[model samples]
Target chain A: MPKSNLDLINDCDSFPYDTFPSQQSAFTGYYTFLLPNDARPHGLLTSATVQSMPWTSDFRIDHSTKTVHLLPASHNPADLASSCTSALSNLITKAIQTNTFPILHGKHSEPYPILGAPKGPISIERFARSLFGLTARGAHLTVYTRTVHGLSIWVPRRSPTLFTYPHCLDTTVAGGVTTGEDPFTCIVREAAEEASLPEELVRTHARSCGVLSYMGLRDEARGGGGGEQGLVTPDLIYVFDLEVGEEVRLEPGDDEVEAFYLWDVETVRRGLAEGGFKTNSAVVMVDFLMRHGVVRPETEGDYVEIAMRMHRRLPFPVSARQVL
Target chain B: MPKSNLDLINDCDSFPYDTFPSQQSAFTGYYTFLLPNDARPHGLLTSATVQSMPWTSDFRIDHSTKTVHLLPASHNPADLASSCTSALSNLITKAIQTNTFPILHGKHSEPYPILGAPKGPISIERFARSLFGLTARGAHLTVYTRTVHGLSIWVPRRSPTLFTYPHCLDTTVAGGVTTGEDPFTCIVREAAEEASLPEELVRTHARSCGVLSYMGLRDEARGGGGGEQGLVTPDLIYVFDLEVGEEVRLEPGDDEVEAFYLWDVETVRRGLAEGGFKTNSAVVMVDFLMRHGVVRPETEGDYVEIAMRMHRRLPFPVSARQVL
Candidate 1:
């Protein structure tokens, strides 16, 4: 870290540059870590200075408050440099091996407590998640409503018996993607378990659109993984978006779903409007259907552009662009 | 596989109604198999033929000996007049798995095949390949030359290679995608590995004008899994035609090349006039580039135009209408 700028810039001798695609300027310089002056692993620069760094400065490490801040610039880099710091060496290794640098999305980003200060490899899999799965690791079957008449969603009331959230109108099907199983095949099995839909439904309704990656940060200062929990989980979740025709009835595979409803579109609208929805995920589902132009008719056989209308109604926090 | 026509076409129970996106009859069914009776896996099938009675028919049980197979049309209502046969069971299972369907451009296939039977997933991986880090698994990279002065290739002792059968050079910078990576990133890596060209040079000198998929089957039986060897390897390769700066020097990556040479239209014309060259795959590449103006020279540079014209001088064997 003490080397002159020019010396550091051309110091490609330590690492075999030919082995990787990176050039001198394209590659970040060598990195190292130093312990806190107090020698307390948890006692990082937790002084109060970070509480109020220059607003115009990129960011500051508010040691007194243990707050890592950020200063959003008008012009972002073509490929933003991520602060990669992990309490776990494996996560750090994984980050470098995979050619991805992670940065915490929220405030108090530890690895990057000081703005513009170089950080190390960041793992993307460090956040709180409810329900998630990997292909072959899990499967799902979505029952789409097709009728113009009326419909209801069948759900099982949690018994307050299970360790996790119980008694909920759960998705018809989901399971681990045991190694070696194709995702499409897994979905069919899940659909049958959830809705008693035929395996054929899976074959016909097979929709392997694409995948999306989500990354976040975890801080040990907040009493998270600093010692044993230092750093966070690194993972890749494979998502499958699929649907089955409305004609399919929800068949009981187990006590998973005690019942389902065949609700009409108006009932859904009413539920959304009244803020009476049980789970936010249901809203996500409704939004997906609406975006794809699936909705109820104004009257039997009457029509309204559901997808367009729903899109217009939603307040988008992100820009209207595909996931980069 | 024994049942009357009445039991076959009219029997609702034997039909796999569940496979239908709609209970309509217009849609087709496809299937896939992980392995043959011997337990080796291959590829997925793109087509199928079924018997009409009791939906009873036996599909091809072995290589070079395929037969019609009938399967239940739907599982929603399993009320067939007779018990299902092994053939029927296999067919129905295949249909439900969606392995019976083939992906477009999934592999290089001839425009036509005589067996008239669909390909199978008879699962297997590459048997023999290059031993270096650049080969093996689903990952690897290769670099070829591209048109610079004016779009023409010069071949030197081209033989045994899949394209440029007679060794007339053309289409540089072509390469393969490596494991755990997508094609977009692989090609750029290939260029660097082969020519030591910086990414900026490659990006600025090249353009991803378009893409195409093909299966290069020939006038012989194709070996699959443990079956007899075929003349082709099925790969979903993406073709990228590049245009480089005229002054750039050529650097061959490995011993795979005998030597490198840059040729203009007259040079190429002289080579072909003296001998002629055109590998089946090379023919396809050239046809693709020419038909799309992907390697047009007049617009590229005088040398490039001359080189492109030299390609035209080759006895392409097929007419523009035929190849185009």
Candidate 2:
């Protein structure tokens, strides 16, 4: 039997991350996450506190609470990104020294600003790496086709040469929401790039579903890099479902995706149980199945638990960020 | 301004009620609730502890931890109901003494058994009152009509003579799931009784969307009677949406409902802000609006908080009960 969603999130507790209040000059509602002193450190931290980092004096770390805050609350995203570029590059280089890394693709863009809504472009690599110590946001699209038999999901397999979760099953279209881009725009671009789908078809058929959020330690074994094991990953995934008819054909539009597979719900469930899909994609699929009534409380013993886990309920003010 | 969902549930914390493990003799997985010493009395308790209650020799309450337990592990729902009849009647009579109460409606049937999947019948009143200290489950239906102007929800003005939330707005149809009954059947029955809708139309139009669960103190101000304030109410509300055509008309099928109002989204939002709807129905409407794109993150500052609040995330294992 496949492990329940509750089991997957058993260790993803949020209490360990102490919170830092917004600084006097920055946006008022947003909060930043700080690793507690007792937490195991990944390679990212220079010392036990955020203030000890020698790169730039743009952050504050409270020793009493062990909380970390970005300084000069009005600091521009571009200037912040510019300041962190060398430090971020060094960290990525250190990671590559321990593992084979793939060259980054797509335009480096700014995602919705975490604290304030600002239009600024940051490298996608840095955003994913949480170089600024903020949660990252992404858009994941689940493309499915319904026939007389039942529902079948369009699954993509990552290229073997990619650095992250390569050759594993993934959602039909998934991409990080860049620093300055809207979720809808990001998903539309990804749909065309990853699946060779027309913009019109994606815009016409796509529905904005709810979101999936999670905070957890990065899986170091997956080639994210060894000393990177305890790097905190806080993500807010905006989910969408696109329905395609039998007449529509999907081919890999980019080298990042190796191939596509249309698998029935049962088959998908089995594969998910056997760990055939990427972790985030599996979470999205499980949520999709639950929402469509393909899975029910009677059939699944942990249905309530699974449903609650998808919400994540991160304490950060994600909606207050004008960027989304 | 309409109160945000977070504001509405600000004081509705899920503590004060201590958990009681299932007795060794009865079911293995079922649990019950007991009020802690510091909490206010709900008037339902015969004594400060569950052990002191005379009716069921099956229950045990530990003073040190303030934990309660049902002793007979194998006690069936029917047997449990039978054992608590007199005690439950006492609570009901006490309630009646304080306020005018309406006669309970619907078939007094047993719902899905909690621990083991067995068929049995328990009175709707007892189940709603949770005489056995089990979570009560019910189904609520939202019937709406879509036209050129926009979508209009069929809101029922509850009868002034009714005991609970008198004259307040309610869903198109809502009813408690009785023992030995299924959610679908209960909703269908409620649709016909509360709205005079044809059974065929109801069975065909109603779609099982999802569920909303909450755990809080039952309102003592309502006709459920004073001192009823502290009684813990853990509920799993199965939600459904029924689509009706413009030509269809809705009338109160019974005196439980006084009138019907077809209100557009804006009007309903105003009414919610003005405190025109019952509490639970307000939650259901907020969820429906969010799901249907009527409420967007851009327009609603508390969108994330509202969405998270709808899940409730009660600690009790609602799924352990065989009943849906």
Candidate 3:
């Protein structure tokens, strides 16, 4: 039996935060990572990771409160950034040397921002984000063209050599939002680098269709990076829709994407139902179906629940301005 | 000073459920309305309303737990609907006759579904919905046309004589979703009845853009409806987008709207910033701007927060089936 559209959403947003008790229990035993002078938690640390990791003076783990507090070397924005970055860098190096976590082996030099952090210029290496359950922001673009029959989407298969979710179906152009880069700019850059899409074509046609936030749990079934299971993953994906002309073509520019396939609506639905697409990409496709009127209340029983779950109110702070 | 885009959103989603203590206090002292066999609350009632209303065998108000459990006349669907309808309708009639809640005076004969109720074809008169703090479902359509200066929306002004939100700007076509009516069908019907839009045009051009769910508080500042203030209003608006040609003209099919104006993007923004649009309509319009890329993260610092708040999770059940 194939999975329903709601099931696909649950595959990505698997954390149980529906009930008041469940929400309380979801983070009860986890070690909270907080900035100095802030009551709101920025990240969650598992007991196993907290026990195995080496401690530096920059971080003070209060066992009583189960909190890991970031004690900055200085309050200045640049100094805070430098101190935190060096401390995390040294920890990642030690983990790699001891072969503790294979996920750190695929670390890139790119810095991913802690989105809602109060202090300025706080970021860590891209791959090590999951170690402390911080919210990861990314941009995903769903490119489609109207055909005589219906709409067809440009889908890509991930390169098998990639470390995470390799050889799975993906959005036309998708990438992480690096530090200081907005979502739109990130998508444009990823489109050019990964899909060989023309800059002018993307800029002119792509529509910002809002965002999807979910609390994801990285378990072993997700495959790729060999890390401990049940790492709390909160994600905020900025979704974009690009309606291209039938004449336009997409080619893989790098080894990240294996190939591009232009699949019709039915094919896309079948792929989603069969669990062939990557979890988060499947969620994006489900959102596309809902937005385009392909999936509706009349046909789908879980329409309202699916829409609400896709945009779950993430527990962490999302904006530096503290509007919430 | 003009309000920023995020301020416009906060006008509708003003309830502070961001913190644990705030969420706990939001419904702490309120009376819970539950079905006989269910533990989850279907509605919330204020103590004042409970004291003034007449009670029958159908409902048992437990002062100990601040709960009003509906003891259905029978468990059958038809019987349950009849019992609830009669119980609420009689209460509404007495309230209107004695001049208790002026909101009941504006009631229509149409029935509104109790969207996640466990038993029966449960529905009640539309006006009585706020008294019990039930989730209200509606359909809103945003009609726009592309021109030389970008997108121009067809905005409507409510009739000054209307019962609620008089003389305020509204979406192109908006109305409540009556019982047994799906959102798409409701929108098509509303478009024809409210905006004089052709049935064929609406059926063909209108695209289901998705939904916006918010927890709204009905207060005195909202105006026109003479109801008790601070009514818990959880709304699920099925939003649609209709792109029409420039030649199309909209006239008032009924007295709900006085006239229609084709406001350019700047005018719409100014109207929103100046607090001209009706509260919920302004929210729907802001959603339109976000979907259309008029509001970008590059310009709005509260980008992520606005998107998340627009889709706050309702506490009660929403769908008939137990998908959640």
Candidate 4:
């Protein structure tokens, strides 16, 4: 049976239609989350529904100003950092208790990678990621090759005992954009750590393929924290396409990945249709198929919708006055 | 003397800060240009500013609804197509009168590649491109080679007698994204036409390296129309990085390009600093250097700003309701 576009996206992690208010709300106020690479808002944030979450206690919403204050204006960098850290620690402890320890619990020793914040070591960034309170930018590499049979994708099976969708399929190389590191640096580091590939080879072969931004209500049992309330996970993964020769092989360089396999495009499509791959990874693969012209509007009835869904609209203000 | 990032972008074409109204204005309304392959608004358009332009006679703005209707709802696609054709023909005629005929006046037989438009031929796409009224999406290929001494970029010199930016330095191969064509297919077509590279070789060597989206106001003497009003040229060029062997030699295949040269990275940077290359091409080169780690953020004070500027925020609605 031929799989439809809806079938492919059926199990993919997606935000509920009513998760975010269609219009700005007076009660919740705007400035719910931080904008990546920019300090502006294109539209007002109306996550009024999420204001009552336990992790959001540190943030104060002012109905009078219709704004979200991340600590008071009188708070210095030190005070702000302390508040963020304290809030994040409580959330992380609770999350870890239910989901087990994270596979890569990074040192909270770096300054949070805020767009316009002061630079210093702050571990709250890691906590922010677990809570999905903040949008964590990262680079994902989809390494593939063309053979006589046609195109095949290289996928990694995550370690079974680790946190976060353990035993699921992932892109060839993926990791978070840490506080001090850029997308390229992160991709290179992850390629070496997650997959035992030579640095020189990875550098030459990998190519940046824009960003895949998505907002989803992640499951608590799937290593995402915040209990059944479900954290709003806003992620921006800088997609990279790398074409390697047939001789190149990938071995699991770290414990994050359990094994590596090269699956043909047919197998990949079927996996995506059957919801076998991790939701995010499936989105990435869908993007790959669209770019390569494998999936066309004629073949996929919801082609435009699928293509447009790859990026979520982030509200960015035109002026710096909105920056808190 | 080395040039700073500001120096590099000083003369580059860009939108005026005031072109778009401040914050979803009801009087002017908001129509965001799209970030490619996504339904996100990367930037907004205030038709209030454009409503007074010479060629925008057909576009009617409804302040109450906050929408800029391309044509009256009563007008059919055929009627709208005729209006677009009439506007484009006049603009093209005026443009050609001054700068010799265009090297390649593409067939108006293709549908206007509006995201939500019907799939049929419409000549107005060319007019939209020349007027820079709506954003035009295209794919650009930056072919380079890795040598023992580091990297060298392939540059093409535009023909002195050409219509647009005559004799200016360009990427190894560059072209527009025709209505129905995807980036990969466009690149393949352009590679053969501009650089005379074999189709098979281009397919194997080229790698998709994200997109460089910028909004610029171009000059009247150049191919850009809209006269003194200076159309806001919103462009999203899908950047391709093709690594070729040191042995391959490129010859200009089409009359659009006068000559081809392979300059090392240092020479490319110096040319860019001195404004020897076209403004957009300069931006693209800077992006290439940044991704390859040839440019460091610590060394470059405007690193973050430069990276973010490559992709301007365009305003795109969630639904497919904005087709003209």
- Top of the candidates by lDDT: 3
Runs in model 1 with CA error above 4 Å? A1-324, B1-124, B128-170, B218-235, B266-281, B288-324
Cα lDDT of model 2 by residue, B135-201, tens digit: 5667888999988887899999999998668999888899987666767789899899989999999
How are the candidates ranked when ordered by TM-score, highest leading?
A: 3, 2, 4, 1
The DockQ scores of all candidates, in the order shown, are 0.01, 0.17, 0.60, 0.09
**Candidate 4 per-residue lDDT over residues A18-129, each given as its tens digit:** 1211233221333344322233322233443234334445556555554444442334654665555555565455445444334215333333454333323234445545
Candidate 3 or 2, higher DockQ: 3
What's the distance in Å from true for residue A168, model 1? Answer: 49
CAPRI band of model 3?
medium
TM-score, model 3 to reference:
0.95
The better candidate by TM-score, 1 or 2, is 2
Top-down lDDT ranking: 3, 4, 2, 1
lDDT at B122 for candidate 1?
16
Worst 10 residues of 4 chain B by lDDT: B18-27
Q: How many residue pairs clash in each candidate?
A: 90, 20, 0, 19
Tens digits of lDDT, candidate 3, A76-150: 654666677677777776776677777777445578988777766578877778888889999999999999999
The Cα local distance difference test for each model comes to 0.30, 0.58, 0.83, 0.59
Fraction of native contacts, model 4: 0.00
Cα lDDT of model 1 by residue, A87-192, tens digit: 3223334334553322312212112121112222222232211000100123344455545563343333333453233544343355544323444566677667
Per-residue accuracy of model 1 over B1-324 as CA lDDT, tens digit each: 432211211121111211101123211232222211222112223232222112223333232322222233442223321222233334334443543222211222211111101221111112211000001111122123445454454233433453224344434444544323444466677667655557776655443322222222222232122221212222333344454555666666644444556666555444433433332224323333333334232222221112211122111111111110
Model 1: per-residue Cα lDDT at residue A123: 21
lDDT of candidate 2 vs native?
A: 0.58
Tens-digit lDDT track of model 3 for B102-168: 6676445578988776665678778888788888888999999999989999999999998677899
- Predicted complex 2: CAPRI docking category: incorrect
* lDDT of candidate 4 over B1-324, digit per residue (tens): 766654565345355332211333221334443322333332344453334334344445455554444443334555654554455455445444443223214233233454443323234445444333455666778888899998988898889887657788887887777765777788899999889889998788677655556666555544432343344566667677788989988899989888888999888877777677776777777867766656654356555445545654333321244321
